[model samples]
Target: MKVVIVGNGPAAVSAIKAFRKVDKDSDIVVLSAEEYPAYAPNCMENVIRGDIGDDALFYAGGFSFYEKYKVDLRLGKEVVSIDNKKKIIYVKGGEEVSYDKCLLAAGASAFIPPIPGVELGGVTTAKSLDDAKRIRKWILEGRVRRVVIVGAGPIGIEDAETLRYMGLEVSVVEVFDRVLPRMLDKHMADLYMKPLEEEGIRFYLNSQVVAFHGEDGWVEAVEIKKLGSDRSIYLPADMVILSTGVRPRTYLVEGTDIRLHVDEIKGRVVGGVLVDEYQRTSDPDVYAAGDICSGIDVFGRHRWIALFPTAQQAGAIAGYNMAGLKVKNPGLVDYNAVKTRMVTAGSGGLFEEADESHTFELDNQIIKIFLRDGVLIGYQFVGLPKVLSVNKNNPFLKDSITFKFTGQGLEASGVLMHHFMRYRDRKVTQKVLSVIKNGALRSLANPSHDIPLFSL
Candidate 1:
C-alpha cells in the first residue's frame, strides 16, 4: 500500500499522521514543490519581523518527524498533473510516481493579478516562507522604507502592522471600500480600521492600482486611481507586496478525470476541487484537502473557508477515509481572527442572513451578535489595543481587553457555534449572549478586570 500526498502543508502533515495511525505499514510518500521541510503558514508574519530561520517554523517538527513516521518526503517535486485513470502523478521534471491512493493537498499560491509593471523586482506576494524572508532581507539591507501594500486583506494588513512597528511608512490600497472585505462588513471594518489609521498605517479605499512605476526594473512608486473619479496619486515605495489573495494549485487535475468546482462570491471567485464528507473526490483512489478543496460549511453551504484549522481537519479526515475509517467531516465553520498591535478582530458564520442581531458598544470594544431563529449564526467582535486609548488610566480598562482576549473570542465563538450546529435547535445563542453580556457589564463596572469582550 503506497500513498502519495501532493503537498507539504498542514493538510498533508495531518493526513500523513492520521493515515499512519491506522496503517503504519503503508508506504507514504510526500511530494512537495517547496524545497524545505513542512512549515507553519501562520507563523510567516512573526517570522518576517524576526531574525529566525525557516527551520523554526517547521509544522511537523522538522525532517525527523517524517523519518520517525517512516515516510518518503520528496522536496521541490511539483506535481504537474495526475492521471486518475492510471493512478499515476506526473511531476514537472518528467518524474512519474505511482500510488495506490493519493491526497491532493498541494495547497494554494498567491494570485498576482495581470496588472502592468507587476513583474518589477521589488514586487512580491505574501504566500510562502520565502516571500517573508525576501521582504525581511530587503528591510534588513535598508532597501525598504516606504512600503506600499497593494491589498487590504489579512496578509497585507498584518504586514503593514509589522512594518509600521518597525518605523516604516506603511500604506494599504484596496479596491474595495473597506478593509478585510471578506471577513468583515464595511461598518465593522471601519471600527477596526480606524485605530490602525491612527497608528499611522494609511489606507487608500475605493481605489485601484493602475500600475507599478519603477526604475532599473525595481519598484519605485505605485500609480493608483480613485474609482469613479479623475483622481490619481503616485505614492513612493521601497517595496510592493501584492496581498490580493490566493488561488489553489489546480493545474495538476485540470486535464484529468478529477472534477473541480468554481463559483463567485462577493464578486471574487472562491472555489476549488469538490470533496465529500469523507474527503473523497469524484475518483475513489484520489482524495483532496486544504485550500485545494472546498468542503461543506455548518449551514450546509458548500463553500471554501481557506483557514488553517479547516485545512488541518480536512487532512485528518482524508487520512482517516484513506485508512478505511468511514468517518465524515463534521463540516466547517467560517471563522477567522486577525490580531495586530492596534486592534484584534474576529468574525464567523452567517452575518447578513441571520434574522436578528444585537450590538454592544463598550469601552474600546464593539461586539455584534447575530441569530437566525435563536441560533448562533453570526458574530463580529473587536477590541482596540489599550495603548490606542487616550484615557490610559481609565479605571474600567484592563491591560489587553482583546479584539485573544480580541481574536481568542472568535475561537471561543467557533467552539460554541459548532455545538449549535451539532445539536440543532439547542438554544445556544441565549447562553452565548449571556457570556457576551457579562463581559460588557464587567467592562462597565471595572475595566481593569480581564474580560474578552467578544472584542475586535
Candidate 2:
C-alpha cells in the first residue's frame, strides 16, 4: 500500500511512526509545505528567546530524521488540492502524487484578521519558524524596541513574554476580558499575567486592534480601542505581532467532496475536515489529524484544539487505523501547559458555564475546578515550579504529591491536566479534589503508569 500524508508537523510524523509499527512494508510518502523537518511547535518561543539554536529547530538536526525512517520525504511541496475520485494530490508546482490512501494533517495557519496595514514590513504572526526568525532578527538587530501583540491567547501571551525577556517593551491587546480566555478563568488568568506584569509587560484586556500605522512600509505603531468605547489609542510599536490564534488549514479540500465543519462566525472553516472516531473522513480512503480536523469534546460537541499533543494523539490514532490496527479517538478533553522562567500554568475542559465551581488558593498555588451536575467540566492552575510540587513551606503540599510533568516539561500544568483528565472517575477525581481542598493537588497518579487510556 502507498499512503500519502499531507503534512510535516507532529501529526504527520506521529502517523508515520504508528503506520511503521503496524505495516512497515507499505510505501509512505510525507509531504511538507516547509523546507524543514518536523519540529516541536511549542519550541518556537525558545528559538525566539535564543535558548535553542536554529539548527535544533528541525528534528534530528536536519533531513536525517526522514532518511532514518526509510520513508519517501518530499520537502517544500504544498498540497494545493486533491482529486478524491482519482486519489491524486496536486502540489502548488503542478506536481501530482498518487496513493492508495491519504492522510490530511495539513495543520493550521495563523488567523490574520481584516485589519488594515497588516501588509507592513514589521508585522508578523507567531505561527511558523520563519516568523520566529523574523521576530528574532528584529530584536537582535535592535530594530524593535516596543512590540504590540494582538490577542492574549497562548501564542500572544508567550510572544509577549519572550519579547519582554529579550529586553523589548511588550504590550498585549486581547479581545476577551482575560488572558487565555479559552484555557483559564478570569482569576487564574490574573495569576498567569502577574508574572509577565512583574517583568514589565503590559496587557490591555477587552480591547481590539483597529489598524496598524507605518511609515516606509514598516510598522511604527498600532491603533487599538476599548470594546465598549469609541476612543482609540495609538501604541508605539517598532514591530507588531498578530497572535490572534489559528484556524485549521482546510483550504485544500474547499472544492473537494470531503466534508468540513464550518464556524458560523464569518462562515470560516472551523473544524477542518470532519472525521469519525477512527480519523476516517467522509472519503473512506482519506483520514485526517492535527489541526486540520476536529473531534468531540467533553461536552459531546465539536471543538478544534490546535495544540501539539492533541495533534500527536490524533495522528497516532489515524496512523493505526490506516494501518488496519483499528484504534480510535472518540473524543478528547482540553489539556495544555505553558511554562516560562517565571511561571508554569495550564487548563482543560469547560469553565465559564459550569454549574458549580470551587477555588482553593494557597500561598504556594491556586487551583480551580468546575463541574456541571456532579460531572467534571473544567479546571485551571498557575504557580511556580517548586510551589506546584512538594512544598515543605506549605502545609498542604508537605508530602502527598505523586505527580508527573507533561507538555514541554511543565509540571504545574501537568498536575492540572492529570487531575483534569482523570477527574471523571468516581474515586480518583474526588480524591484529587479533596486533597486540593485540604492542602494541594498532590498527585494520585503513578508516574510509572501510562495516562489512563480512558482519559483520552
Candidate 3:
C-alpha cells in the first residue's frame, strides 16, 4: 500500500509513526510546505523571547527518523491539487503521485482580517518560521520600537509579553471583552492581564482597528474604534502584528469532492472534510485528521477544537484505520491549559457567559463550578494546588470542566487519569475510584464513595 500525507506538523508526524508501526514496508511519503522539521507550534513565543535557541524547538526526531523508517520526506513541496477519481496528488512543482490512501493533515493558517492599509509595510502575521525570522530581523535592525498587536488571544498575548520583555512599547487591541477569551473567562483573564499591564502593556478591549496609518512605507499609527462609542482614536505604532488566531487551511480542498462546514456564529470554516468514527471522509479512500477534519466535542455536538494533543490523537487513529486496522478514532474533547507564573487547565466544556455558577470553599482555596441542569459542566480554581487537584478529579464533576490553579499542588490532579482510561483496556475499580475520590481526604476509610469501581 502507498500512503501520501500532506503537511509536516503534529498530525502528519503522528500519522507517519502510526503508519510505520502497522505497515513498515508500505510506501509512505510526507509532503511538508515548511522547510524545517516538525516542531511544536507553541514554542514560537519561547523562541522569540530568547529563552530557548531556535534549533532546540525542532521536534525531537532528526533526519535519522525518516532514514530508519525508509520514508520519503519531501520538504518545501506544496500539494495543490487532489484528483479523487485518480487517487493522485499534484504538487506545485508539477509532480503527480498516486496513493492507495490519502491523508489531509494540512493544519491551519493565520487569519488576517480585512482592514484598511493592512497591506502596508511593517505589518505581518506571526504564524510560521518565516514570520519569526522576518520579525526577528526587523527587531534586530532597531527600526521597530512601538508595536501594536491586533488580537488579544494566546498568540497575541505571548507576542505582547515577548515584545515588552525586549523593552519595546507594546499595545494589544482586542474586539472581545476579555483576553484569551477562548481559553479563559473574564475573571481568569484579569489575573494574567494585571501582570501584563503592570509590565507596561496597554490593552484596548472591545476595540476594532479600522485603518493602519503609515509614513512612506512603514506603519506609523493605527485608527481604532471603541465599543459603545462612535469616536475613533489613533495610536502611535512603529510596527503592527496580527495574532488573530487561525482558520483551517481548506482552500486546497475547496470546490473539490471534500466539503467544508461553516460555523454560523463565527462565519468561518470551522470544520473540514467531515469524517466518520473511523476518520474516513465522505470518500472512503480519503481520510482527514487534525485541523483538516471536523470533530464532535464531549457534548456530542459538532465543533472544531484545534489543539496539538487532539491533532496527535486524531492522526494516530486515522493512520491505524487506513492500514486495515479496525480502530475507531475516539472523537476529541476541547481541552486547553495555560500557565504564565500561574497554572490553569480545563477540558470538555466551557463555563459560558450565559450560565449559572456556584462557588465552594476547599481548604484555603476557592473552587467555582459552573452547572447546567445539575451537571458539573465547568469549573475554575483560584487557590491552593491541592484544592485544584481535588476539584479537577471530582467524580460527580461533569465530563467537561475547566480548572484553574493559583497555587502549587495542581499537578497532582488526576489529569492523566482520563488519558490512561482512554489508552488502557483495564477495568476501573472501587479502589482506584477511592484513591481518586479521596485524594483530598487524609483517611480513605469511611470515604465518601458514591460510585462503584472495578479492578484494572
lDDT of 1 by residue, 80-153 (tens): 99999989999988999999999999888899989899999889997798998898888888898899998998
* lDDT (tens digit, per residue) of candidate 3 on 278-297: 77777888888887778655
| Sequence-dependent TM-score of model 2 | 0.88
Per residue, candidate 2 scores C-alpha lDDT tens digits across 1-456 of 999999999898889888888897888999989877888788888878767864666654467767766779998999998888899999998899999999999998898999999999899997898888888888778799999999888878877776765667889999999988887877888877776676588999999999999999899989999998899999999999998878788888877889888777788766768887888889989999989888666567777778887888889999999999888685676687765556667788888778888887654567777887777677777763332343355322214332222232255456656655654644335555565677544444444333442243
lDDT of 3: 0.70
lDDT of 2 at 312: 84
Residue 75, model 1: lDDT of 95
Instruction: Give the Cα-based TM-score of candidate 3 against the true structure.
Output: 0.82
Q: How accurate is candidate 1 locally (lDDT)?
A: 0.80
Q: What are the models' TM-scores? A: 0.88, 0.88, 0.82
The alpha-carbon RMSD values of the candidates against the true structure, listed in the order shown, are: 6.4, 6.8, 8.3
Instruction: Go through the candidates in order and give the clash count of each.
Output: 20, 1, 5
lDDT against the true structure, per candidate, is 0.80, 0.78, 0.70
Ranked by lDDT, the better of candidates 2 and 3 is: 2
Regions of candidate 2 where Cα sits further than 4 Å from its true position? 54-56, 262-269, 298-300, 384-409, 427-431, 447-456
Worst 10 residues of 1 by lDDT: 396-405
Off by over 4 Å in 3: 54-56, 262-269, 342-348, 353-356, 360-367, 380-456
